[model samples]
Target: MLRKPTLLLAFGIFLIGACANLIWVEPKIYMPGSTEIEVEGHGINGPVDILPRGTTAITISHEITNAGNSPVPAGYQITETVIQWVFQRNIASVGWREGDPATHTIVQLSQSGPALDPGESAVISFGPFTVGSCGLFGETLELDSTNIVVESSNQDNEDKHLFFVPSNQIINITANTINGTLYHKDGRTLTHQFRINSGGAGNQWLYTGFSWIATEGSTADAVPAPTGRVPQGPAPQLINMFVTPKDHDHSPLGFGPSVKGKVTAISTDGCVVKQKAVEVLVEHD
Candidate 1:
């Protein structure tokens, strides 16, 4: 058994050692970092650019991960993300802003309670922000913009994305001459060539689909016309379609004078219509 003073001294020494250990030992350090690139919409495979017509606003999504060995406290769940957009047409300028053009936009993208544990990831979506114009546009996203989070690495906190919106003249239509003939009509089949232009990034017609209609003004033939559909492939620049005039009259419109006709195309998505007139030479038997 130890004496009272010796026991007291031992207890004091133990306490001192405990205090030293508590003070000197390193505390658990956690850091939240963004691992995936920010995308334009909610879905992972959503379009980054080539937005549909009449799209005035959009949303963005990104993933954050706790890359440390410890856990992040729920108390520090405040969001400090910043998103900025700039027009990229002929001249670069500021994109559309909701209220107070002078003020910047701050986004909140925090998850619900339950602290973020190590190796855990959380996905957050930000915005319904304006889509300034129908042209090339650029935007920047910076996570932890306020610098409130103590991160081991700050280099990966920023990302940039470019998107495009097309004007009303998204596609161009043209009639090509077939085999030396200005506009050839084989039997009753009238062939016309069309070229679909992409709206900077993706073909706008691909999403909505397209159809064509041809009318012969001179003869008013009552032949059934073929149904039209937008062609799909790896990348299609030009497409040709054969149209038949509806049955009505077989009156001779004269070969030398040519057959005056018009081709009309309408997009399935927005009902955008484009018309092209052509003169064809028919060798009717």
Candidate 2:
């Protein structure tokens, strides 16, 4: 038989041990920091069309941003895969060439200096890539192109651009001068030529606007009439016109002596594709 005091003490100790076992404690979970990479189109620096038998240089610029909460390690490589599609020439309908395959050119760009912090951005440029003459050329640039970077999402890493290459000829404008000098005298006529060398793949129809302006502070004896938005085509066409100068130099209508002939080619969407301007200095002979 145990003493009363000792039995009570032992029971109390057991109750305390049981109460401790009943108590519940929550656990703390540590989630890892996530990293995300993003690419956006910045700007494109190139011509809309490449001349026949000539190559055009193209450059694509983009901005890379760290979109997640974690930092991206420095020296990590980012890849851009470029796919080129060449269009068929002389096709009645818009079509792409079958033989010319998409060239999966892989270009690698690396992060320099310190690691890219969260919400940080960097500008990157790719190519001055030489594109040969074709009817139309299309390109798709996929960033993180190789899936090399472990990002939060890979869906929005692509950008696309286009170019038109004239297989037959290029849109051109020129003037004819007997001895390389065009004298802008009253009643003197100058011959101007506009050549529309038309066949292209993507954008077949081009709108050209012609205007003549005199440089500021000089007197212009004559101004040519505007050729409002002429649509050019698949068939080659050449236009010749003459501009005769009035006695504007002595009148208030004359602006300047230096004359500039500006020809602008625009697309269907109102985008200026090509612009050519030439200035001539005329003296009273």
| Per-model CA lDDT versus the true structure | 0.41, 0.42
How well is each residue in 19-138 modelled by candidate 1, as lDDT tens digits? 100000111111121112222211112223445655566665556666655565554332323343332111221122222224434343443323567667655555665645444344
TM-score of each: 0.35, 0.37
- 1-285 per-residue lDDT for model 2 (tens digits): 569989999999665443100000111111121111111111223323232333455555556666655565655444434344433223132233322343533233333322557677666555655654333444444545445545556665555544444333344444444322345454444445555443443343343345566543332221323223444555644544344443335436754455655554433332224455556555455
Task: Look at candidate 1 and give me any clashing residue pairs.
Answer: 221-246, 221-247, 222-246, 222-247, 222-248, 223-245, 223-246, 223-247
Lowest lDDT sum, 10 consecutive residues, model 2, at: 20-29
Q: Which stretches of candidate 2 lie over 4 Å from their true place?
A: 1-55, 89-92, 97-114, 165-168, 172-285
Model 1 regions more than 4 Å off = 1-48, 75-114, 172-285
- Cα error, residue 225 of model 1, in Å, equals 38
Judged by lDDT, which candidate is best?
2
